[model samples]
Structures are given as structure tokens and as C-alpha cells.
Target: MITIQNLDKAFAKQKVLSDVTIKIADGEKVLLLGHNGAGKTTLIRCLLGEYRPDHGTVTVAGHSLAHERVAALRKIAFVPQLPPPIRFTLNELFEYAAKIGHCDIDKIRKNSIYFGLNTDAHDHKAFYKLSGGMKQKTLISIAFSRDADIFIFDEPTANLDTMGRDRFRERISADAMKEKTIIFIGHRLEELSSVVTRIIELDLGKVIRDEQA
Candidate 1:
């Protein structure tokens, strides 16, 4: 389980998040909703231990984000808003991530198919050469391959086409059935309705709504 209490963060003179408290039970699927600059990304960063909270605490699977960064990261896999810089082919990237994440190649290959990645294209082309949707698919494939207890994704559907968006949600739904905790940050609530079990809305760094969908 993840427990966040009184979380606060600020940048320069502006507060990005304040007194934010939330709890995510194991296996729960949550959608984080907010406009641009509403702190969704900031909150995900804090949860991933990429940014330290100015005050308060965040605990994931019993490990505190501030005290046990590596331990905390071990339990979570994060996909950022921007796709990762593809300095190599999709296969090479997957091999590197699997080695570091200790994931199985067979499983990663399966996820690659699940994400609609053309094995031939991904196998031969450099990541930078793939289309935007393909890059996002590769990013998601890497995240799922980690097999972490929790997954955090920010703006995952941004560059996807209609079919790609549907396929992405389908993959998410399938993953959720495996009982992994998923925290997704996105502007499109309608697209997430089918897979998201709960919704948390943020405005100017404060959580304004928390409700089951």
C-alpha cells in the first residue's frame, strides 16, 4: 500500500502541491485528473522519489520515499509525460531495462505484442525513428516489463492515435487484472473511465476531489 500524508512542494515562489494526503491500497487503479500545471506531474515525481517534498511524507509498500529511495523505486515503475529519449532500438532498450529491472524477456515480448508494437519494426529501427505512438508504446512496454508493485504514468495517451489510445487502455485493463497498483495522470477522463477505479482531481496543487468512478 502507498500512504501519503501532508505532502507539500513548492517551486520558486509558487506552491506546486500543498497538504496533499492520499492512500492507495494494493492492486487499486487510480486516475489523477488535472489541467496543465495543476501538480499532477509534480505529485507523480514526488511519488517516484524524483523530487523531495518540502514537507510531509510519502510511503510506498512500507518504504518511505525520503528515507529509502532505492527501496521505494524498486516497488514502483514510472513512465514520464515525455517519452524517453530513444538512443537505441526498441529491442536494445528493452534488453537494458529488463537487465536493470530484472524482468523476463518473454514477458517483455508479450507486453510488446500487447501494446501493439510491430515486432519487426521495433526489432530493426532505432527508437528515435519510430512514430510518436510507437515510442509511447515502447515506454509503456518497458514500464510493464519492470513488474513492479506499482506503476505511475503521466500523460500516457498524449501522442497516440485513436486506435493507439484504445489499445493502450486495453493493455492497462489487462495489467490491472494482475492486481498491480496503477496511478495514471492524464487530462482525458473519458478515455480512462473504463479502467480507472477511482479518480483524484487536482487544482493548483491541491486535491479538490476524490471519488470512485
Candidate 2:
């Protein structure tokens, strides 16, 4: 479902990823574990086409990110480390997502409720004004509501509380993500053990370990 070949990236004179390569098959849920500056985010950016690789190629479902960025990205559902600073109201945000993603707003509302976010209560609230947990829930809800073939989440639990995390796990458990390629970047792997079938660890911008769980 995803492949990276001879990927290299740098900022100024400092390298962030060095000849990194990986291939993740469909339905595999991978935990991208690494400390800060370990190049995890850099690699993700390259895969997402947010940062063109200094060298190499990233392909998703046979679509080259560099050459077919838009089409390739259409197959992915992403929840970033930080929620975007959009001031769109909850309804507007959902509307926009539905328009662009061609996803079901009903699914978004259902998933949000399952994740403990009452969309009805927050429908008039602007995204930026929601509490951290609420924001995280909404983002996760939106991501999951999409029909993308791949799902990527970065530090998704950073703003979630204990209960919210539990709700999140319940929503993204392996069975729930069947046939979808899921890649999650976060330090709390143990908390997500049930959903992860593979582990890919990065260190100092290089892939140090790739193993099946």
C-alpha cells in the first residue's frame, strides 16, 4: 500500500533522513516509534508530499507522490501532530470535509459521538475555540470518516485525556481498520498495542528497526 525508495532529506547542511526505505502492505497497522528529531516526522512529510524528498521516491498504491501528489494524497487520511489553525465553525468544517473528501457527514457525526464528542453541542463552536481534547476528538473523527485507503496520525493522543484515549482506541482498533493501511507516530506504543501489528523505529534519521509484532 505504501513504499519508500532510497529516500533522503535535509535542511540546510543537516540531514534529517538518510537513504530511508520502507514498504508497508495493505491492512498493516504500523507504529512509527522514535524520539524527537529522530526523523519520523520528516519521513512522514516526505511520504505525504509535504516535503519533496531531496532524493528518492514515495509511492502510495502505485501513485508517485512527486508526480501525482493530489491523486496520491486523495487516498490518504491524515491527522497532524497539531490541529490546523482554522477558524471554521464545526458545521463549516464538516461541510468542507464532506465536499472535498466526498465523505459522509453522518459518519463524522456518528464517529464523533462514539469518541465522546457531541457534535450537536459543538456545532456552532469554531474549531480553534474547542478544548484540546475536543479538538483532537473532532480531528480523529474527521479522519476516520474519510474513505481513504490509508490513515496516518501523528502524536494523536497528545491532547487527549485518559477517557478520550480509551475512546480513541475503541474507534481505531485493528478490527475497525481492517483492510486499511494505518501508520501512527507517537511515543505511547503500549497504549496502542492492540491496533499495531508492526513496529518501525527510527533513530537519528535512519531506520533502525523494522519488525512484525
Candidate 3:
């Protein structure tokens, strides 16, 4: 389980998150919804150990983020808001991520097909040449390849067409059904309703609502 107690954060002179507290049980699919700059991304960064909370505690699977950053990070995977703007091919990107993430290459190769990444695209095409949706798909593939217990996704369907979005959600839903905890941060509410079990809304710097979908 993941738990946050009295979490607080600030940037420059502005407070971004204040006394935020939440508990996410195992296998839960939680959606973080809000307008731009509602502190959703900041919270995710703190959870990922990329940023430090000014005060409070964050624990994931019984490990404290403040105390066990490396250990905590090993159990979580983050798909950033923007896919990396790199010059490497899709395959090369995955290969590098897998090596750094310490993921299983064979499993990643198998899952790459589900992302609609063909062997041809994987072999020689540079990431910049792929469509935006394809680049997002490749990024997601690499994130899931890590086999982390918690998966954090930021605006996962930003650039996908109708069919691509549906296909991507299908794959993610399948994974969630297998009891993976997914924390999705996005502004697209309609797209998330079908997949999210709970919705947590943030306004300014506070969690204003928490409801079951």
C-alpha cells in the first residue's frame, strides 16, 4: 500500500501542496484530476522521490520515500508528461531504458507488440520520425517493462487517435486487473471514468474531493 501523511510542498514563494494526505491500497486505480498547475505533477514527482516534500511522510509498500529513495524507486515506474525527445530508434530507446531500469528484455519485447510497435519500427526508425502517438506508446512500453508495483502515468493519452487510445487503455486495464496500482494524472476526465476506480481532485494546493467512480 502507499500512504501519504500531511504532505507539504512549496516552490519559490508559492505553496503548491499543503497538508495532503492519502492512502492508496494495492491494486487500486486512482485518478488525479484537476486543471493545469493544480499540483498533480508535483505530487507525483514527490512520490517518485524526484522531489522532496517540505514536511510529511510518504510510504510505498512499507518503505519510506524520505528514508529509502532507491529502494522505493525500484518498486515504482514513472511515465513522464512528455515523452523523451531523443534521436534513438524505438528499439534503442527501450534497450537503454531496460538496461537502466533493470527490466527483463524478453518481456519488454513481448509487450512491445501490444503497443503496436512493429519489428520494423523497433529496428531502425528514430524516435523523432515516429508519430506523437507512437512515441507515447513507446514510452509507456518502456515504463511497463520495468515490472514495477506502482505505475505513475502523466497524461498518458495526450496524443493518441481514437483507436490508439482505446487500444492503449485496453492494455492498461488488463494490467490493472492483475492487481497493479496505477496512479494516473491527467486533465481528460471522460477518458479516465471507465478505468479509474477512484478520483481525487486537487484545486490550487489542496485535495478538495475524493470520490469513488
Task: Report the number of clashing residue pairs per model.
Answer: 0, 0, 0
Instruction: Compare the candidates by lDDT and give the number of the best one.
Output: 2
- Per-residue lDDT over 1-213 for candidate 2, one digit per residue giving the tens place of the 0 to 100 score: 799999999999999999999999998999999989999988999999999889999999899999999888998999988788889999999889888988998898888888888788889999999998898888898998998889999989998888878887887874667888889999977888978999999998899999987
Between the candidate structures 1 and 3, which one is better when assessed by lDDT?
1
Q: What lDDT tens digits, residue by residue, belong to model 3 across residues 100-186?
A: 899987767776677676756456888878887878877777777886888898988897777667776887768444588889988
Arrange candidates by TM-score, highest first: which order? 2, 1, 3
How big is the positional error of residue 141 in model 3, measured in Å on the Cα after superposition?
A: 1.0
Q: Write candidate 1's Cα lDDT for 1-213 as tens digits.
A: 999899999999899999999999988889999889999988988988888999999998889989998898896888788775678877888788888889987787888787778877558788888888888878887888786888888888898777768777777778455598889888778888887889999999999999988
Clashing pairs in model 2? none
| TM, every model | 0.91, 0.95, 0.89
Task: Flag regions of model 3 displaced more than 4 Å.
Answer: 125-130
